[model samples]
Target: MNQFIPCGLVPRLAVTVVLVLVAARCGGGGPTTPPPPIPTLTIACPTAEPVQSTDNNPRVVTFGTAVATGGVGPLTTTCSAASGAEFPVGTTTVTCTAVDARGVSALCTFPVVVRPPPRLTGTRFLAFGDSITWGVDSPPIPAAAPSFAYPEQLQQRLAARYRLQTPQVINVGEPGEQAQDGGIRRFRSVLLQHRPDIVILMEGTNDLLSLEVGIERGIEALRDMIREAKGQNVRVLLSTIIPQRMNGFRVPNRNPFAVLVPPFNDRVRALAASENVPLVDMFQVFAADMSLLGIDDVHPTVRGFQVMADTFFEAIRANFEQQVAAGVGGLP
Candidate 1:
């Protein structure tokens, strides 16, 4: 009673079904699609502190050695602070970032500390005087040299006492110069130029040599110099002249200049007192000891200079300590 089905039609139908399944699996009808990839990035921690110079002012810092890792291939690297460029003093943040072509990025940060220079690093002192102040008989030696003139020795001693910065003592001493030349022609300009914290005024020996010019001229010149220095707001430390001997021996009697020296020193004391300035009394210590004198009657030997340094150091210590205690001046 049932009708018979066609065998060829059944086979064609089976083949058509297989083709449809293959098309769907291959995406033959539309664009092909793939699974999305996960993005990745990483940054290494810096191992050391950034390097920089210690100076009074801000300076450049460098950090080209910082490392970064996996992002997309062929990564580009950059930093927030450029290498070898000026940076401010104190802690500066440095960030180094690496970016791949795909825009995936990684970053690392570290701190750089730029310490400011030591306080009061330049302690300026103008050693204003004649040949003696210039480190005469023996030329002035550097602060680090073995043998120092009084001024250089004074700087060393002061540094030791404070246990802090080394002072710069500029010797502007002219050999054979009287107070007239120093105070009138040289004092004001030097004071203005150097602008030192202290001026050690020691002159008058040459002026004493001239009986006609007299000691008064030297005294007056010193007074003028002191006034000029004070006008500039610079402190003055007045030093009395040291004893004189002839050729490493006592001078014969009738040394007219000897009489004048004591009086000249007396005048120096009177001037310092009148002006209310500090005094380094070299004369008091030297008056009894001819041994301190150099081959020349006027100049000091090495020992003499050391003695001078000792006297000056005492005055400097007192002044420096007083000022520091009162919160006036010392290490900034």
Candidate 2:
């Protein structure tokens, strides 16, 4: 058979066979490379320093200060004490964690001990405000029946949640009394007299309604209140006014006055921020369900007052807990 074929044809045929075999082999792709493994993270707290306290309690020990891991990226840290571990009377433990950008995490614990809350024999809280602050539109209307205003509700919630002794809450809200009036004559005589641990200032509604005072004046009044309170070492919590959708407007003439609400709230928010005071945004809470207000649309109903009280309770509880943990001697 080879003798009959051309000499070039044999070599060509051999080359063709080799090319076919190569094509067949290349038809299926080669195996793929595997992905890299995810990095692991671990955390620990090392006992290093002991905190001292005047109270007769065990000193607290802190855990690891630095987090070490194999991976690299931005890391976030969080700390918490172990469960069921009683913070020794004089000391407490704090745990911290570091998390990398890849979601890897590491943890550490530290101990810090200090004097506990002073055996506060008693504590007083004062609330100052306008009509709403006085529970003007509260329900079960005998018009004369005592309305459990937000302040009273706040007291109850604090007692239940924090196990704090029932504090004497004095409500000094005078209906129709503008902040100007309060700043000039009322605040000192009534509020400063009690030596309150905390003071809640809810004024400015009357100021906005009566004098149409601008935001600057409101801020000044708030500053004055804060200055007075700080002089006595009393902590202050400022609250924004709830929005009013009154039927009659007072600005350009007696028409719908809803437009005024936003401007007033803006001023109050700015004042709160500049003063570095805790602000309870009551308008948003009440505005969540518009039906909570009374028929007149200015005052919140009983349910509305409950919601307001709850809001106040949340802010107050957080502040109190922090102050307690810090062993700071001042109103939270």
Candidate 3:
């Protein structure tokens, strides 16, 4: 049966089968290639808008939302300024940026306007002391030229120098009241009534009159007063009792009843040092200027009151300096 088939035809058939097998092994198509990947977009907040507050109170603001185009994980936002890195009042701008899983990033801008906070007009002061502080002995005068009590003089000085507009000084001194008596009464009348920013204490003079009252008790009373003020975030200024040459010149001794002065001053100094309260050394000031004293020996003359007022002014100015250094500007 094969005698009719040609030999060349058999070879040709074999060659064709080989070529088809080779083509199949080679995948029978054009060159292999992969499809392009999808693009991802994202945003990052590099800076935040400035928040302005007119008042001294703190203010807080929020940043806008961040977005990412690709399937990325766990994004975070942050804020910063260009120069000082602190946010101040008025118009401020921040740069916003975005990143994707592919390490590609985008950038934009955020604009913010901050308004001022409400202003605090004035601060209150509370003066606690004895006869001199109460201005009890001063003669009556017209309202315009009211007898210049030390507290009144302090108020005037603060208004003029520190720019404390309409500052209020509440004198809570009671004549012949000792530290113990004043401490017991202050919580209700002076402390809670006005909630003063600062409390100036001119006490212990009457306490010294009693030879029986130990120095420790006076110290304790002073500490109590400080604790009370600290509870309400009020500052304190302690003044040393002025030296007395004689007890109203009525006593038999020509020598000073000044025995009480040294001990009382010592206790006050110790209390002030321990409690970290500001102190005005009226003793030193008055000792240098005896002319300020009146004939009564206990009370200070008009000139003496003026000197006391000057000492208080120095103390207040020192406080202002401390506040300014601590970054607290303006009145309390």
Highest lDDT, which number? 1
TM-score of 1: 0.56
Off by over 4 Å in 3: 1-122, 137-146, 212-214, 246-248, 253-257, 321-332
lDDT tens string, model 2, 183-230?
546676665577788888877666665444534566577778877787
Q: Mind giving the per-residue lDDT tens digits that candidate 3 earns over 1-332?
A: 22333323344545666545555555665677887665555554434455545343434556655444543434333333342343434445666565544456666555544444422223578888888787653222212223577888877766655442456677777777888766556654578888888888878767765654745566678888888888888888888888776544544642434677777898888888999998888988878876666666666777777777788877776664333211212112
lDDT of 2 at 280: 81
Clashing pairs in 3: 42-98, 43-98, 44-97, 44-98, 53-117, 54-116, 54-117, 55-117
Residue 268 C-alpha lDDT in model 3:
85
Task: Tell me the whole-model lDDT of each prediction, alpha carbons only.
Answer: 0.70, 0.63, 0.64
How many residue pairs clash in each candidate at the backbone level? 0, 19, 8
Between prediction 1 and prediction 2, the one with superior lDDT is 1
Candidate 2 wrongly placed segments (more than 4 Å): 1-122, 138-147, 214-216, 246-257, 323-332
Query: What is the per-residue lDDT of model 1 for residues 1-332, given as tens digits with 9 covering 90 to 100?
Result: 12333433333545665555555545556765886655577766453343333233566665555565666678777777776777655566678888887888888887666644333323678887777777765324222223467777877776654444667777777777888764568889999999998888888888877853669888999999999989998888898987665334434532566568888999999999999899988888887787676655667777877888888777776664432211111111
Query: Candidate 3 versus the native: TM-score?
Result: 0.56
